[model samples]
Structure formats: C-alpha cells, structure tokens
Target chain A: MDSIIFLRPTRGLAALNLRDLWVYRELVYFLMWRDLKVRYKQTLLGASWAILQPVVQMVIFTLLFGGVANLSSEGVPYPVFNFTALLPWGLFSKALSDAGRALVNNRNMITKVYFPRLVIPVSSVLAGLVDFAIAFGVLVLIIIYYHFAPGANFDFHFTPALLTLPLFLILALVSALGFSLWLSAMNVIYRDVGHVLPFLTQIWFFITPIVYSSSEISSKWQWLYALNPMTGVIEGFRWAILGTQSTPALLLIISTLVAVVVLISGLFYFRRMERSFADEI
Target chain B: MDDIAIRVENISKSYRIGTAPERYRTLRDSITNAGRHILAARHLAARLSAGRSDLARSPDPSSHSTIWALKDVSFDVRRGQVLGIVGRNGAGKSTLLKILSRVTEPSTGQAEIHGRVGSLLEVGTGFHPELTGRENIYLNGAILGMKRVEIERKFDEIVEFSEVGQFIDTPVKRYSSGMYLRLAFAVAAHLEPEILVVDEVLAVGDAEFQRKCLGKMSDVAQAGRTVLFVSHNMSAILRLTEETLVLEKGRLAYRAATPEAVDYYMAAGFSDAGERLWQASEVPADAAPFQPLALRVRDPKGRVVDTARSTEPLSIEVEYRLDQPITGLRVGIYLLTMRGEYVFTSFDTDDPGKFEQHSTRPAGHYVSRCTLPANWLNEGRYVLAVNASAFHVKRYFWDDHALAFNVDATGAPGKHWPEPRLGPVRPALDWMIETL
Candidate 1:
C-alpha cells in the first residue's frame, strides 16, 4: 500500500480528479446514507410528507391551470397529466436546491479533512432518488385512481414504453446535476447563488411543460423551450408513462444536447474552483 | 532516501483575505463588478480610502489583503520517526498540517508521501449528534480516510477503549460531553494508518483524558509509524517525540531534539522579563470590550525585577481597562516552565467569595494582583500567559507571549549541600534527624 501520493496547486481545469472521486466512492455512499438517515427522523410523517407535497402540488395545478385557465392535457384528466410531470420535476427541483447547498452545509468536513469535494454535492443529488421513489409510488396510485373513476381514463400497465421511465428519470437527474454543479461551486465563493435559486426555480417551473402538454406550445419557440433540459425530461416522462399521442423526438434531441453540454461545462467550472474551496468556504 | 515516509520540498501557501469570508461579497457587488474588477481593483479601492495619514502603522499586518502562511518550508521524515511541531498561534503550524493532509494545496512546491495518510485535525471532525456512537465511529472513520475493512477490523478495540460499549447504540447527543469527546477520540485512536497528521487533539478533554491521550500517542510512536504531531502542550511533546521543529512567524526557526526545541520555543516568546506591555495599535480590534494593557513581576522588596529569589514571595500584577460592563469575566494567568510545561493556573476570581463579590465587573480601570508563596519555585526560567474571557462566551483578549521571568533557588532547604533542584517546584520541608 505504499502509494506515493503527490500534491500541488491545481490549475486551469486540470483539477478534475475523477480518479480521486472514484477512489472515495465508499465515502460517497456513506455521505448519501447519512443524508437519507438524518433526513426522515419521524418515519411515517417523513414518507407521507414526501408524497403529500407533490400530491398537493398536483391538485393545485389541476384546479388552477387545468380548470380555471382551460389548459389542455390532451384529453387525459388534469390530475394524471400534472402528477406525471410532477415526479421528474419534483426530483429535478430537489436536486437543484439540496445539491446546491450541500457544500455550504458541510463546511466542517471541507475545512478539516481531505476527500474528493465533488462527493458532497453528488451524493445529495443521488439521495433525491429515495424521495423520488416514494413520490413515484404515489403517482402510480393516482394514475390507477383516475383510470377507474368517471371521465378520467388513462392506463397504468407495464408497457415496453415504461422501460424508458428510468431513462427519463436519469435525464432529469443529469440536467439537475448540471445546473447544481455550477450553483454549488459558485455558492462557495459568492453566496448570491443561494438567494437567486428560488426565483430561478420558479421561472424554470413555468417554462417547463409541467401543467400543460408540450403539444399546446407554439412551434416557433418549442426549440428554445427545449433548451431548458427539464422540458424534455417532463415531456419524455409523460410519453413514456402515459404513452401520449405524439413522439417528442425533436424535443428529446434538443433537451439531451443542452443537458450534456451544461453537465460538461459545469464539471469544468466546478473543478476550476475546487482548489480554493477549503480556503474560501 | 527510500526510507523517507514524507518529502516536502519548498512548500508554501499564501492566502488572499479578499476571497475569504472577511471581505463579504454581496450579489450586488458581484453583478456590478462582475469582470471589470475582482480582487486587484477592489483592493486598490480599499487602500485609497484608508488614506496616507498613518505612516507609522504596520503594513500588511493580516488585514491588508495578503498573508503567506508558510514560506519555503521543507522537511523529510523517515518511515518510523515521530516529529513534533511547536509554534505560537498564527505560526503556520496548522497550515502546514493542512497542506500535507491534502486538505488544501500549496501555493508553491509539492510534497510526496509513500504511505496511507490519516489526519485528525480535530476529534470527531464530522460527528453528528443525531448519529449513534456506533454509527458515528463508522462515519467518522470513513471521513478520516480509513477504509471500510480498516474500520470493521478495529471496531471492537474502539468500543473497548472508549468504555462506552453498553451505550454504543445510543445517539451521541445523549452522551455526556465527556462521553462524547471520549467516543470521538476513541475512533481517532483506533486508526492504524502508516502515517498520521494530528493537531492538538489533547487540547480538549479533562486531565485524565489528556493523560490517556498522551498514553495512546506514545503507543503510536512506539509502534514505529511516522507521525507529524503539532501541539502547544510542551510536556506531551517531550514525552512522545524524539525530534521537534520550531516555527516562528511562518518560518522554520529551529529544529533539534525535543527537549532543546521546547526550551528554545518557550524562551523565544520573551521580549522582556519584568514587564510586558501592549500599545493601542498592538491590541487586536476584536479585543475591544476588554484590552490587555500591561503585565509586571515584582520581587519581595516591592521593586519590579526580572529575577526573583525562591526564599521570598513574588507579586505578579495585571493592569487593564474595560470599555464596557461584563459578566462572568475571568482574568487568569497560566504559569509554565521554560520548556512550556504547565505548573499551575490561577484566576483572580477563583475564590468563591471573590467570584460572588465581583460577579459583574463595571467598566473602568482595574488592577488584578496575586502572590506566589516563598520557596515555591526552583531555580529556572518560567513563562506567564494572561487570559480574559467570559465562560463559554466571548474571549476578549489572550497573550501567551505576555511575559517570561527567572527564579533563583537560594537559602532554601538543603542549601548547604549545594545540590541542583530536580523538579519545577521547590518546597521547604520540616526535618527531624533523631535516632529513631
């Protein structure tokens, strides 16, 4: 075990020590476990609250946007369309806020010990999965509940298309991790990112086609709308689960491209700022 | 060369306070000054506003932008050598440890280590009170750079040493503070890496716990592992380390056997013997509510002197002015030896009646004095450090380098024999030489 480790100042995006990140994968798992463990202290209320939050949001959107504004859900009842989008959207938003604050919240570990700094934010992003799984179960129940009721007719069968559900879920996480990487790193130097996060998430929610189907948006701006990666994630989730009318090939292509680009750039930006974190944070 | 466990070559670190939290950056500032000005421009603006009036004011004394925490410091430690590092506060001791642990990068140069490294900057660096003692051991072990198998292998020993086996599953929040420190330290002690970087771990805990830590550290040293130990506890250094490095003002001041290094390090704090004073400019801004003014030593003759006789009581006095009323303030002195080992500590309000009478000290000029009994100290040099702080609250001022004085043993017990005194204190004993 005589590994001669070398130390020096990192420069110019050369600090992306993915090997270091890989070496401490156990720490990554432990941190993720700790977050999950400490998060839900009261077991029943914790899981219930996780499902309760999205169900309440789905109801509000169905009543306000679905009923009052006469927004089209492509003939599917408003609740199923809205909740389907809410799953990925909820997962994405949680990653944005939670991952963004992970570094600042663990300043003790940063200033004290040596580990791959990326593990902190990355673990929080992944830990959002547990909450996502809880809410997803509720979404399935909502789908079945609406199917048997009057005037609400969508199915919840295990289709070959449902195989793509995990893919869209992964896509939502990729897009979140992208934006989160930038926000968390910058949050270390300038705390302005923390204050700006809520407002940005609010606007992002309106931009993504969460309340209404992507078919309602005018074609001229659809490409620009897909620039926000969550648009494709929400749209893709509806098609994969609900098997919505049209295939969103163009939307998927644009959204995936943007998410991959942001993730790569965010990775570079994070590594560049990684060296100063211990001192600056 | 092959036996060297760590090789640090010309390592240095410089911190720009501009980026640190001290120079808080708001969103408005970042937006308005986005690219046109970041560090350089704003620094110039700050200087221009401070003006040119105070020419005699010290330049770059910590607040003026840049500080080099370590300067061209280099060293090598053989595979089984335990090295001690001693320094005054801000002497770059902790910064050096930070660099070697890879917690931060050096601004210049590099270091190579040929073994698994474990750093204990503080006991329980990431212990969550919500976590059980058993769980915290695993979590804390992982954070301290221990592998999963390592923690699993040593789990039993850790619980046994901590002596909290019965309560291992209880949340550490419920543990007494003493129990908490014990459990945290237990995990750290069980780390059996080839190399260790420890910082003042003995500084916490009670006297018994400190002794236990000293015992554990000696065991580590005796086990033939390379260790870099930094501490202000001179006695512990003398006991555990064979060699020591002395750091002064961010530079390597001296290096030698532990005894010599400790003596030099302790004596280096002396600027004068009879009296020490701090000027208005010398006092740190944070010490505003209470500022240290002066410390003086006087002989039995009532004359301020640098040297005192062991046969007569000596008086030590501290003078200061408090700008505001304070509660629970304890103005105390720590008496130590030339090797920096503690003799005893005394506070002006240590007496219960005195503490009750002066529970709240009003703002004004004050003088606190105490006397050391005659025939109490042996012939040697000693150091006194002053502290003014409220319990568990704000620390107004502290000066470890406040004063150093000499004590002479004369006309005491066994004066006719002319034998050298053996320990820190010299006590007069009543003797009866009857044929019994």
Candidate 2:
C-alpha cells in the first residue's frame, strides 16, 4: 500500500521549513534586489517615488485633518504627524498589494524553475521597502525643520525606544508577508482573489490608523485593536520617534505575539498550497 | 553507478481532472464534501459508545481521489550522456522533467540529481515580457539559480549566440516571436549548468536557428555535461542523443540506443506499408474543401502501384470525391521536403491539352494524374496532395492528401541515390549555361 501525504489546512504548519529558505539566501537577495531595480528602472524620478508617496500623503492629510478637521497632532506639526503614520502604512499597503499577487506575476518562473516558493512574496515585500527607504529620508528633513532641536516641549524627544523601530518594522513586515503569502498562493488557483486585493487593502488601511492616531480609540477597545498587529507597530513607531507616552506596553506585547503567529501560520498555508500552483497556474 | 548523474526512484504524481464547462459543478461538490466531512466527524463521535483516544489521534489518507499522471517511474542517466525522451503527446514526458527539475514534488518517490540544472521547459518561461531583453537575461539567470557573477561572466556570450545585439535593450514584448525564442534559448543554453533539460521549445524557430541550437546542444553535451532532451523530431533526436527512452501513456515502453528507440517509437505509432498515417484528421491536408479518397501511384492498367523503379515511367494518381462541379478547376500537386519546405509544385494543366472541363460529377471517380518523365524525381519519400481551385486559382476550396509514396532507385543495380536525396522529396532539374 502506498502511503498518502495529506497536505491541506491541518498539515500546512509542518509543510514549510525555514531551513530550506536559509539555504537559498543568495537567491532571495538577488530576487529582492532585482525587484527593487525593476520598480525604478526607466523612471525619471527613480528612488524619489518612495519619499514622494508619503510626502504627498502628508500634504493631503495636513490640509484635510489639520486644516479642516482640526485633528490634534499631540502639539506637533500635522504634516510630520501624518507623515509619521503614513511611513509604516505606506510600506505595509504597497508590500501587501505586491506580495498578494507575486506568485501569479512569476507564474512562468514557478512552473519552469525550482526554488523556495516563499522567496517570491518575501522579495516583493523587501522591494517595497526600497520605496520606504527613499520616503524615510524626506521625513527626517521635515522632522529637523519642525523641531529645530530634540526636546520635551517640541514633542520630539529622541529616546532609547528608537532601538525598537527595527522590531516594529519587522512586525509590519511579518503581517504583510503572512497575509500576502496566503493571498498570492490562493490567487494562483482562484483568480478572483486578485480582483478583491485592492478592496481588501482599502479596508485594511482604514483599520490600521494610518490617517489617524490609535490613541483616540476607546480604551476598552484598544486591546482588540492591538490584535491587528499593525496597531501596535504604528503606535510603537510614534512612541519611538515622538517620545510620546510609550505605546501601551501591553498592546505592543500582544500585537508582537499576533504578528509572529500570523507569520508562521501564513507560511505554513502558503507552502501547502504551493505544490499545486504550477499545474493550476 | 558512480558516474550516474540522475537517479529516479519510484516517482509518482497525480492530478484531479476537471472540465472547464463543469468547473462550477466540481467546485460546488468540493464545498459540499468539506461540509459533509465536518458533519460526519461529529456524527461518528456521537455514535461511539466509548471514547477511543487512539482513533481520534489519526486521520485516513486514502479518502481523497485523483488521477495519477505518473506512476512508479524510475530511470538513471550517466554524466555526459545525452538522453532523448520521445513519446506521444500527454505521455508524461513533461511531468517527468518537471519532477527532475524539482518544479513540482513527486508524490511517492524522489529524483536525486548530482549537479545544478538549467531547464527550458517552454519558450518565454522565466521571462517577463515587460522587462528588456537585457533585464530578462539577468532575471532568468537568477531564477535558474545561477550566481550573479556567473551570469555576468557569460552574459556577452549569450547575447552573441542569440544574434540579438541590437534589440538587447528593448523589452521582449516587442520582439518578434522568432526573436523571443532565440533570445530566450540563448540565455538558457549559455547558463552552463552541470545538467541541461530542454523540452519541445525548439520546434518554433526557423530551420537555421534550430540547426544552430542543435549544434549548441551537441557541443554542450560533448563538454562532459548531462543533457535530457525531449522532442518529437526523430531525426534531430537521433542526431543529438546517444541514448533514448520511449514513454507511452506514462510508462516506459523502450530504452536503448537512439536508433533502436526511434525504431520502436516509429513502429509503435506506424504501420508496415510505409504508411505512417495514424489520425488523418490531425494531419492537415494540402486541400481543404475536398474529402480525400486515396493518393497512390499506378501503372498503365490502373492497378495501384506501391513501389516505383527509378528509371520506369510512373503515374502519380490523386483521387478525391467532390459533392458538386467546380468550374475552371485546376488540380495542383505540391512536393514538400522533409523539413516542411515546398520543393516544387506541378499542376495537371502544366500541359495545355491536360486541362479538362467538368460540367458534372465524373460519375464514378475523379482522379488527377501527373506523369513523371523517366528518372526525373530522385529516390525518396514524396507527399502527393491534390488541390481544387478555379483556373486562375483566386480562391482555393479543397485539397486532399490522397497519396504519399517512396521512390527507390534500387532498380538500377549498379547505382546508389545521392545522400542529399534522403529528404522527403527529391526533384531532378535542368542546369544550362549559355556562353556569350
């Protein structure tokens, strides 16, 4: 009797092995770098599109919220406030959009070549980070202009909490990678997932507090918001840079756990579905 | 055994066959199955008189069903050996290569490969149409698992081989299909992996390019690298591979030297009368609107002639059944070379007196005869197709492949036909020089 391997919802967790990914580190870097260069190739603005995105969003939000809605910026310039929130959100949204369908975009590669399938979505997310880097440079200039010097009164005190920025950025990366892995893998067999990605991202953006601060949500609901993962990341980013009341430590703790959980489980599901992608695609 | 570069062990893969017209039907069935599975688990638990911890801990694996594309297939190839895979369409050749390349997992077994693999499963694979040819080369190389520095080292060589120097910077989307195939093949062939796997992608290019690619594969194979080639072209396969594996419906039918395997494949799919015709419908006819009766050769008595002597007078007869009378009709015959090029075309009206008017159906049969002047066409297999059209041939209605035959010059005991005449068709021509 031939033993059959059941690879589905239950076995997904064991199907993905991180060691295989590590073995192909060079491929991952090449794929990520290739995506980064391709995104900016032949463009007149090159890397400026990254900074341009959040800066443009900052101007719009400053006018609409600061100018019209009178939304408080915690005694800081609204442009910087809005730009700060937009940075991580920009990274998350773009990463999600690209990674969500990376498998379909590379269907030729999947069907013809052999490699770690996770590398496709991982590279897409990393490529989006290039835009984040270019956009991050512009944010630093705005911060220098508004605060003049780092201090408590300027609401721009640099603190040791800044060390956790990488941690938070990684959190956002995990959330995007996790969700995109599932989406991209599913998109290979069901094309309708591609059509729904944009609408789902829109809803996801609103729920992440990119245009507003998470502080204003009712305290009773704050814990549930942390379950979103990005909720803690955005709040943590604000805390690290602005030195505001440190993001509710408890929410940060909870969201970090959620992000880890999503990353592992998402990878599991993606690998389980990947074996059939070439045939179906 | 030490020299073996690829070893396949009991590999199997299966897929669920689905119909596009019933796509929704199967989809709904799967959803309903999922619901039933959940409900049945609960029902079984409730019916149990006592709790069974051991049974609850495990799940059955055989409950699902699928059709196996490959089953228990195993093979071994030595390093530097050029292996040819030949089979009818859908015979699992592509599936085997996919498994060897690790593009998809084998359900039951494993293939252990000794070195890096460079595979070109199909044209335009691993190529992004929006990317320029130069960009795609790097992208494809990376995707093929080539190191960046290694790709850069051979990048110029690939461009030169493809003969697309001028269009290297242009996006591949704008390139002609031929140019796309050339450039894509260049990148794949030049990658210089330890093992190269090529599918039927070489079928699209011009004969010259195909010759160049075949030459390259031979050179690569000679360089002590392994190659697994899959193609329908028997002559090309014989020219390139030393060993051949013939597959039929996902099972190994024959494995031996190229010539023997080629013979097996030919005999398996063909009949002894030298008539290789399998499915007449699949082979496109030279004429479209007419149903072909038979294309044969005959002597003066009208008895079907199966063979012809080189020096003997022969009549090529093409018979087709037509439903209605076509005015000013000219019956055309074309002889095509083995490489699929038209060598010559002759019509029944080549001689003025040969044109006959048809006011009604020739009550019994309609036959077009082309008389071959003594020893004109050389000895070889020639395809004879008859076409019906107006005298001017402004619009063609039908062509029938009524006959295909071979001419042997063996009747002249002391002579041998020239080697170049081994092609599908051979024509004797006139060569004259006028001195001024």
Candidate 3:
C-alpha cells in the first residue's frame, strides 16, 4: 500500500524529489521519444537534417579558417580537426536550446498535470542525443574518407583514449542540461530567456574552441577557458577521436568540477522556481 | 481516522492582485523594485534613528496588494466517498484542486492524502499532435501519474472505450475533434488510482460522452476509491456524489448530502439572504452613477425568499441609485439554468412603452421588478444575472450568474409522476383522451 503523503508549502531550499523522479522515469523516456518523433515528423529532410547541420558547419569553418585564412590545424587535416570539435559543439548548442525552451513549450502539461517537473528539461536534453548520434556517424565517415583518400597524408591513430569518448559526451550532456535547467526555469518567469537563447548559443559557440584549435590560446588563459566546461569536452573529443593533441588533464579536471557545480546549483534553482511555474506560466 | 482518505486543514491560497495576470516580474523589474525597496528602507531607518515615531508605525506594504483565493478552507473525505465541489467562477475551486494535485503549492496549511492521487485537471493535457493515438494514450497516462505497466495493462480497454481502434496508429492530429476528446477521456477514465481529482473537463465532450464519464465516475466511486469532482453541471453532481461542498467567496459555506447542499448553494446567491447587496467596497470605482443597491427574489406576498414554489408567481427586483441622469440606460435580468443554459433575458425597458417613458430619467433612486407567471419554470435551480447597459453604446455593470434561486414543484402539474421532467419550463398542456 502507498504510504500517506503530506503536502505543504516547501520552505528554505527546495530538495530534489529523487524518489518521485524514479517512479516517473517512464514519463521521461516517453517524453524523450515524443520529442525525437515530433522533430522529424512532416519534415521533407527528416533525420537527414541532423547530419546536415554539423557537416555544413564543418565545411564552412574549414573554408573560412583553414583554406581562406591559412590557420594551422596542428598537423592534422583542418576538416578532420574542426569536424571533431563540431560534433560535441553541435550537441551542446542543440541540447541547450531545446532543453531551455522545454518548460515554456509544455506549459499546458505543467499546469494541468502532476509529475516530476525535471522530466521536461531532462528529456529535452536526452532527445538531442539521438541527433548527436546521427551527426557522429557522419563524422566517422569523414574520418575514414580522410584516412584512405589518395595522398591524404593524414596520420590517424586509434588509441585506448577512444574508450573515454563516452565520458566526455556525458560531460557535454551534463553541462548542457545544467545550463538548460536554469534557462528553462527562468524562461517560465521572465520569457526573455527564450528571446536571448539563440544569441547565447551563438556567443557560446565561438568561445568553445570549435572553429579554431585551443592551442592558439596562451597556456595561461587555458585554465580560464576550461571554466567554460565545453572547452574540456571539445578538446577531449579531439584527443579521443583524432589523437591530435595530448589530453589536457588539468583542463579536463577543472571543467568537470565546473560542470558539477553548474549542475548542482541549477538543480536547486529549478526546484526552487518550480512551485510557482503553474501559477506564473 | 483510518477511514478518512483525504484531509485538508486550513488550506489557503493568496494571489497578488492589480498585477499582470500569470506574469512574473522580469529580472529588470525585480532589480529596480529591490533597489527602490532598499532605498526606502534606508530612508525609514534614518527617520527612526532621528527619533521620529511616525516612521515606524506604517504597515507592511505587501499585504494591500494580495487577495486570498481560498481562506481557511478545511474538509475531509472518507474512503469510497465521491465529493462534489460547487462554486462560482473564481471561488478558488480550481486553486484548491491545483494545490491538492501538487501542480501548485498552497500559501498556508497542508493536505494529507492516504493513497495515490491521479488528477485529470484537463483532458489531452500532454497529447502531442504529431504522436499517434496509441503513443498519446501512454504519454497521457504517464502524465496523469499512472505507471507504465498500468497503462500497458489498460491499453486495450482504453482503445475500446475510446472507440478509436481503427485510428490507434494514426496521429491524433488527423483524428476529428470528437475522436480526440474520446481518446483523451478514455485514458483518464481508465486510470485506477486510489484517489481521483477531476475538474470541469467533462463539458468538453458531447452529451453521450458526458453520460459515459458520469457512469465511469460512479463506477470508480463504487469500487471504493475516493473522488473529488468539481463541475458546474448539478445533475452530474446529483447523480455521482453522495456529499457535496459549496464554496462562497473562497470560504466553505455549506457541506451536506448532495441534495441539501445543492439546494443551499442554489438559494445562497451572493449572500445568505438570497439577495446581493452591493457594499461600497465591493463596487468598482468606475461604476459611478450606476451603483446597484440590492437585488432579490421575492415571493408573491413580496417577501424575500430563496426558494419559490413553481405554482405561484415570483418577482425579481433590482434597486439602483443613479447619482446622475443617464439616457438609454436599460437594466435587465438574465435567467439561466444551473448548468448555464440560458432561459431568457428581460430588460426593465424591454416593452417599448416603458422604454419611451424611462428614456432619460433624472437622477433618482429606482427599482425595476419583473414577474414570472406561475407554471413557467421547471423544478430545478436557476441563476439570475443583472446587467445595466445602453443600446449599442456601452455596458455599465454586468454580472453573469450573479444570483441563484431554486424553483420547487410542490403543487405544479404532473407532480404525481414521481420522475423529474427535463428542460427549463414545465407548463401544463391540457390533453383530452377519449376511449377511441
């Protein structure tokens, strides 16, 4: 039998209801499935749009920076170098925007039903993983084409570091979800978060070492760059996939710490603001 | 104590009025407001330090802006009891449900539930237009707090109940509106939670579906689950709930068996006196020169009564004080059934002769009375709304369903049938039946 439950106005800092979330885990999965299906439904291009987004960005970046500006690719082909970073960068930006708008878009559900509210933004971030996987497939083909192309001169090596790719992908997921939690909660109250999100993702894209290599930044500022969380994710992806640069252990550690802080604080803020969502939204 | 499935104690919810509805203050607005508050606090501190007593005597500023949507409302429901909640719009019925469902937090007190709660505050709440009907059933089921296994077990029953078996795989956007409503309601009806909370969502479906929903509710009640049903349809309430609660201005006005509570609510009107007396504070400032003094239903002997026998004439009287002369002003009354079906609207000047005589009366106090002849109304609760408006110009004051009364059929025609008749009016039509 279910035990008695008492409800009252929560006070002080709001505690995350992990048990409630566990019970409603199926809702999270279903919501994620809905987002994935709806994203490709009725569209002419369908899932191909996912592969196209990152591939198109890689082509433009390789042209503008590698071909036109004569920027160095650290002995790796510029296309392979930029494409590796763009894989994680694409996931970060897409997940951020999608999860940020999740709450306001589902105001009907939020106001009308009772579930773990965290499922909304969390599912949005999880839904982006499907697109990320599709885009990742294209990156692998690009790597293979460059490896076997005549006179490619690409010295690609697979190392044990490839096994750590999932860890870095999870890191990217955490950072995106953390930021989205804050943005989605604020979007319910301010509504300006929706308007500011695109601009935010654009500015975030430049600072994450996607278009250019992180080596160009002075070693002194590298620690500050790691504070962005995605810095470590992008650099970690390149090291794991292309074996371009040695792993930045210090940067990865700092980024992981920063990601944890963001996630913890974002969860608290989201739960704190959740009580007013139905009333405000 | 163990028999009680739900207990609510002093649950109150207050909302800040005179602000943008459902809009939160933007970050910039909050920053500016905080800055102003801090500056004001500092100024007050300086005055206090200077030994000025006046500065310390002011009340808290926030209290003036808030309005209580529910005030110290307390109630309980035993296991297997189906309770109906009836109230006028904005009487905090929805707020109470939101608080109970945990969609929103109450401002004060607590509600304790002894079992799992499933609330259908709205049907099709999380249905995605792009998703197929099958997918939406599972999605909506989970949204209503049903477990995945439970939804899976009930999937076939839900589809059959919805009568959408052919379109189960098709996206709901392709389904007609009736099919959509049916599918949504089917998912909600199949949820077997220990307690169910429903709002006024049944009115969305057609009449047949409504009867089906009421039947399902009774089934749930018979199965020993507690239910909280809020609706404006009194007949449904009468049919389903054993006991009912009446809310008046956010307070629990009456709680009794369904029939008695419905009777009390119908006759209560804006006050317990079966009359609506507009106090100075209750009237909006803009309704100047058109202040309604009082409104009441009087028996044939000219005494205020909440319930009138259908066999006699009943008079509805509205008294108003106009501070200035007004032209083309018509004071009217609208009679409607308890289910919000309109019976008729009659203006004091509806007769052209009266309209011509009162075209432009000078400033004075006046009373407008309209009488309904005997045998004109059915045996049921009816609502009366008063309006003051001009022809095609502007409406000064309008209250929809502002007052309510009951018309009892004690001596009306066909009282021996023992079954209630339908429709707003139940007039006796003479019939001659020969042995032919």
Candidate number with greatest DockQ: 1
Cα RMSD, each candidate:
4.6, 7.9, 6.2
lDDT of 2 at B51: 64
> Model 1, range B1-436, lDDT digits (tens) per residue?
3999999998888887565446546666767766645665477668778884443322234457687899988888999999999998789999999998888999888899888778878888889888899889989988887789989999999998888889999998899988999888999888877888889988898999888888887788789888999998888888889999999878889999999998898888677558998898778778878977899999877788888898999999999999998899889999988777788999999999999999999999998999999988988899999999887998888887679998977787677887886889988877779996
Interface RMSD of every predicted model, in angstroms: 1.4, 7.0, 1.1
Docking class of 2: acceptable
What does candidate 1's lDDT look like per residue over A1-281, in tens digits?
57898988766666566898888888888888888888877577865778789999988998999999989998778888899899889888989999899999999999998888888888889888888999888977877788787765655667788888888988888998999999999999888889999999999888889988778788998998899899899889988988886778899999999999999899889988888899989
The digit string of per-residue lDDT tens for model 3 on A212-278 reads 8888899999999999999999999988988877778988999999998999999999999998898
Once fitted onto the true fold, the runs of candidate 3 whose alpha carbons sit more than 4 angstroms away are B22-24, B36-61, B270-375, B378-382, B385-400, B404-428, B433-436
Error of model 1, residue A96, in angstroms: 1.0
- Residue-pair clashes, model 1: 0
lDDT of 3 by residue, B143-246 (tens): 88888889999999999999999999999999999999999999999988899999987878888988888888888989999999998777788888889999
- TM-score result, candidate 2: 0.77
After superposing candidate 1, which stretches have Cα over 4 Å from the reference? A42-44, A156-158, B18-23, B27-64, B280-284, B433-436
What is the DockQ ranking, best to worst? 1, 3, 2
Candidate with best lDDT: 3
Residue pairs with clashing backbones, model 1: none
Query: Which 10-residue window of candidate 3 chain A scores lowest in summed lDDT?
Result: A1-10
Q: What is the alpha-carbon lDDT of model 2 when measured against the actual structure?
A: 0.74
